[model samples]
Target: MATDAAQPSLLLPEAGGGLLAALDIGGTKIAGALVDGGGTVRRRARRPTPAGGDTAVLGAALDVLTELTTHQEWRSVAALGIGSAGPVDIAAGTVSPVNIPAWRGFPIVERVRAHPAVAGLPVVLCGDAVAMTAAEHWIGAARGYRNALCMVVSTGVGAGLVLDNAVRSGPTGNAGHLGHITVDLLGEPCVCGSRGCVEQLASGTSITRHAVAQGWQPDEGPADAAAVAVSARRGHPVALAAFDSAARALAAGIAAVATLVEIEVAVIGGGVAEAADVLFPPLRDHLAGYATLPFAAGVRVERAALRGDAGLVGAAAIAGAATAGAR
Candidate 1:
């Protein structure tokens, strides 16, 4: 595991009081952080996720929590918040992330609460995409927006919505699952049993897959999305086409969200968003074509201000909200 501390910032001023213990659990890593009310990360720990059974995954998360307890500021933690890859049932306090197959309806909240150090503290849970949305609304690109869509386009695509100035996670904590929305009516089927879902075309994994299928070879390094991005920057037709395809799908999905809910802006993040030069120009162009309605036409797409720290900060924001509600 690795640990670090961050400099203080004046973000999330309303998040004053005690600190919040936050956990961001994903296929790649299990991260924990102690965040102050002002959204500054006081201390953090991270560990690679084990590719094992349910017990192993739980153990990894528990280990992150154990390390967090060793911090001097742990005593100031008011509540524990968790953001996990989903589909999660916030009401049931369970999670079933697609990538972590061993955990179907895993009792995440119960297990976290069972931790001795977590005793008596309020526990909050939400989908990772929703957590990102919370962070954006609190201090990132969507800070002042009353309505917005926040997305993460990594190995997979995920999204969350903010409506009327609040995160709208919906009943199953999966409201803004824009990836599963069909963009190509007769396109290839998705793992979610849907045809032409945005994730199948817009995710980093998909971008690489599309590029490779189109005969785009990398100059060096592994043939991943980053490599494809390099090729796109070099003006490779196949690589450029792959990114344009992803941007088109993303534009379709974003436009759908805007048309349906009238979101003022779309804040996009995750690994794929790093290819801003290749992704944004095409995305903007495609969005203009799809979002033709007067209200939807004003929707702006912006890169997420908070990068990697969005998950931890967002989890802390959820914890802060839970603590405030309890008070």
Candidate 2:
């Protein structure tokens, strides 16, 4: 890795070319990075995710990456890695992101390849959850764990599984979508057409919806569930109840996964988990009630170490890992 201090850009060393270029396109943001072999992002840029049909979203992502690649220092990057909302078609280099409806069945790899800077470089696409897990394994919270689950409990719930020290991407590269697991047969309807799914009952959106229905009003805009966490911090009964409801549902989901996989740890992240102190205690207690076995009882639940940058860093890890494996 070489740094150009004057330019605030990174130059990844290639056998003959340069550094690695990574892109992370999520439902909320698009971030690009230049990473070294050790997974440190030498250069980074981010922009809010644009909402629209597929073309508009792809254009937004391209605009962000194009701006990042404009820095002369990133011109010679060797590869590009993409981490996006899944059910991605890894074999076909396409994706049908759950959050971005327009991207359904879009040829993402080809679209990214069209970018001038990354045109010929090897590009690897992966589910965002899997990418997040890879980032944690590469340099974040789950580094020491051979079997861990990294999950996001934000606008929507999603997860990636790492088993036996390996990131798991089952057929179609869309494994470990834990949020869809049904915890309550009669629970709320999910966007995925499932009822009582973990995401339906425990996601940030669900929490806020639950609170608003209980007569809680957020002082800030949008009545975001994040604000409900703020209200809970002030001991608002409505907000606390909202969180408790989410926790109970999430705990059931966790216990079910632990029962099936015997995962060693659960690394939780996303906007909702910011209130870890308020949320985790109840979640742990609920989980205790759900799990009957020792393994499930010992399954430690922790926080995701990486913030928003986890996706980009994870993309870099995937690119670097794939490059190494190929060699």
Give the alpha-carbon lDDT of every model.
Answer: 0.88, 0.80
Clashing pairs in 2: 12-18, 12-19
Each candidate: RMSD? 5.4, 5.6
Score candidate 2 by TM-score against the native: 0.92
* Number of the top-ranking candidate, with lDDT as the measure: 1
lDDT of 2 by residue, 1-327 (tens): 111212111123444546677887777777888876656678888777778788888888888788778888676677788988777888999887666677878998998888887766889898888888888766677776777788888777888988777788887887789888999998767778789988888888889999999999988777887799899999999999999989998889888888888887888888888989778988988988997798777778888899666777777777766765665
lDDT of 1 by residue, 202-304 (tens): 9888999999998888999999999999999999999999999999999999999989999999999988889999999999999999999998897889999
Best by TM-score: 1
Error of 2 at 38 (Å): 2.4
The C-alpha stretches of model 2 lying farther than 4 A from their native spots are 1-18
* Model 1 steric clash pairs: 15-37
Error of 1 at 209 (Å): 1.2
What lDDT score is found at residue 243 in candidate 2? 93
TM-score of each: 0.92, 0.92
